[model samples]
Every structure is written in structure tokens, then in C-alpha cells.
Target: MSRTPHTKTPETAPAGGKAPDPARRSDRSRRAILDAALALVGEVGYNKLTIEAIAARAGVGKQTIYRWWPSKAAVLLDASLALAGDAPTADGRTGLPDTGDLAADLKQVLRATVDEFNDPAYDAPLRALTAAGATDPELAARFTERLLAPQLALYEDRLRSARAVGQLAEGADLRLMTEMLLGPLTYRWLLRTAPLSHAFADALVDAVVATA
Candidate 1:
């Protein structure tokens, strides 16, 4: 009898146990890293957030984080994007709520944003990022490019759709309109100067659409 040659497949387990799926393991680690980043940002503030702290919190090595991301800010940015539903879809569309009533849609989204800002879960981490970004140019650029710009683009898309339907002026400055509509909410939330509410959201929408 001839001795058989042993072949191991990718799915083959070791002698004593089942094979570990690298993809699933990576996904779990990614989720843990993001969750740890978010929780630590809220607890310690972005200024004090560190790779080591995040790694410990995530039960991962600091090198594991560095292998995936360049810095703590990058890690936090990924966490923020994962939490925020503003990322582009697989088709590369913003997927903003457009029910043909731009004003209603705008109000709806803004109101939800207001609620998020009011929730300590979201508010703390956001404040930490915002405050740190204000002082750190590199962080600020990354925050805007990765986190804020996508959201702003979503609003612009909605505004553009409204413009197409004559709900907005032909010469309507979509970018300016977007800023005008969202700028106040951001200011009030970041500055803690005033309460954010559905009514405030409605007012902002009304003000922007009034120019149509």
C-alpha cells in the first residue's frame, strides 16, 4: 500500500479544534476597536485618547490598531463614520431622505441630528472630537474630510433635487443653502448656546426654502 499525501485546505482545522475564520475574526476585532475608540473618546476626551488605551480597551495590541490605521485620530474617525449613517452606499449614493418634500425631509433629518446631539452617548464623543479638531489642524482636516464632508454632501444632494423640482431657485446656491441650513444647528450644538429641537429644525428648513 502507498502512503497517502496529506492535503490541508483553507477551511481545515488544526488537530484539536475548528479552523478560525480570518475574515470573521478581523470583523470582530474591527468592531471592538471602533467601540473601544468611541467609548474611550467619550470617557477620556480626544486629547487624551491614545493607541495604547484603545488597544487595551479593545483587547487588542497597539500594533493591531497601527496595522489598520495610522493614528488615534484615524481610528476615531472610522468609529465616528461607522456610527454616523452618512457614509455613501455601495452604489455611491448619499441615500438622503427625499420624499419629494424637501422641507419635511430636511426637518426630519435635522430633528434626528438634534436628538443625537442631546444624547450624552453621542454628544460627549462629538464634543471631544470637535474641541480637539479646533486646535489640531491635522485632526481638523481629517474630521472634515472623512466625517463632516460626506454629511454636508448629503444635504447638498437633497437641495439639488429640490432645485430640480422648482422647490428651490434655479440659481440656488446649494452649497450655501446647505451651510445656512446646517450651520446654525452645528453652532448651537457645539457652543451649547441654545436648545436644539424639532421646532428649530423646522425654522432652519423654512428659512432655507423661503429663498426659493
Candidate 2:
């Protein structure tokens, strides 16, 4: 799949409970490694991508990458999350939008998610992560923690708020509601059944409101 290299800045948190050396994190080198890793993995696949290959494309020493990340998964995870974060959901707020309108807030976030899915930069790495996670239990856990969990946490917060305001029925299961919103989106992306779009997101929000 032909795609542009991702240049969005990655979050600084390291995998495996360690911090990267500050000196190695200069803007140029960081973007180069991330772009190289994301592109190569999309081309050669996760099983075939190597630190040496990444370093060669990035024009940096293999030691430079290893000095920061423990493994190739760590580098790819960071790169994936960085490009994925470019989605400015949450009502354009830094977090989940708590604008007191539950349906609207959820729709906004879902639309942003759809947009991210459509972007080639975010699409390849995210697909790679999910495919790898299917076979690798440990990678699945780390991917959830470093990527998926934070987004789910936002949904949980919004749902809880809706319950407090009685937008949701009394004793509504928030976990299920979160899945209700996400499941269609995830299924569509996975199957390529159709283009993920704001129209679809709006429809989901409307369905939730009507059924609630």
C-alpha cells in the first residue's frame, strides 16, 4: 500500500517502564526513525521489519534506535500512536468532550476516529498493530495499554456522565454502551464493508439516543 510517511510527533512515554535518552530524541532523528519504521512495516510487514532496516532507512545507527526502544514493536507502537493522535476528537477538546450532550459528544469523537482510519498515515500502522496483536498476546496487552485503553477511558467517562444526567436509562451498563458505539465502527473498518464516515457516526449516535 502506497502511503505518505507519518510525521506527527509521538508521545514521550516509553514502553517497558523506561525513559529514552534525551540526547537521542532530537526532532530530526525521532521523526526519521518513526517515519522509517511505519513505512517499512507497511511494506515488509511486522514479522520482516528489523531494527537494522529501520536504521538504514532512517540514516541513523541501529544503536541509536535500540538506545531508545527495547524492540521493533516498541518503535512501531510509538509511531502508530503518534499518527493516530492527530485525530482531534473530544469536541476538539484535549480530552473526551463533556459538553453535557452525550450523543453529540460521542458522534464527534466517532467522526474523528473515522477520519483517522481514512488517513493512510494512521491506517497502515494501526492495521499492522491489530494484525500482530491477534497472534501475540503480550503485544496485544501493550497495544491496549499504550493505545486503545486511553480512548476507551474517554468513552467510559462520557457514558458515566450521561448516566449521571439521566440521558442513559437507570442502571445502564456503560461498558456495553461504549461497545455499542465502537463495535460498528470497528466492524466496518475491519471488513472494508464501506467507507467509515461522519454520516455513519451520526447514525450510531441517533440510534443510541432513540434506543435509550
The candidate maximizing TM-score is 1
lDDT of 1 by residue, 73-143 (tens): 88999999887853222114455788998888888788878888888878888888888999989889988
Best candidate, lDDT:
1
Query: Model 1 misses residue 73 by how many Å?
Result: 1.3
Model 2: ten consecutive residues of lowest lDDT: 8-17
Residue pair clashes in candidate 2: none
After aligning candidate 2 to the native by TM-score, how far in Å is the CA of 182 from where it should be? Answer: 1.2
What TM-score goes with each of the models? 0.86, 0.81
The global C-alpha lDDT for each of the candidates, from Candidate 1 onward, is 0.83, 0.81
Q: How accurate is candidate 1 locally (lDDT)?
A: 0.83
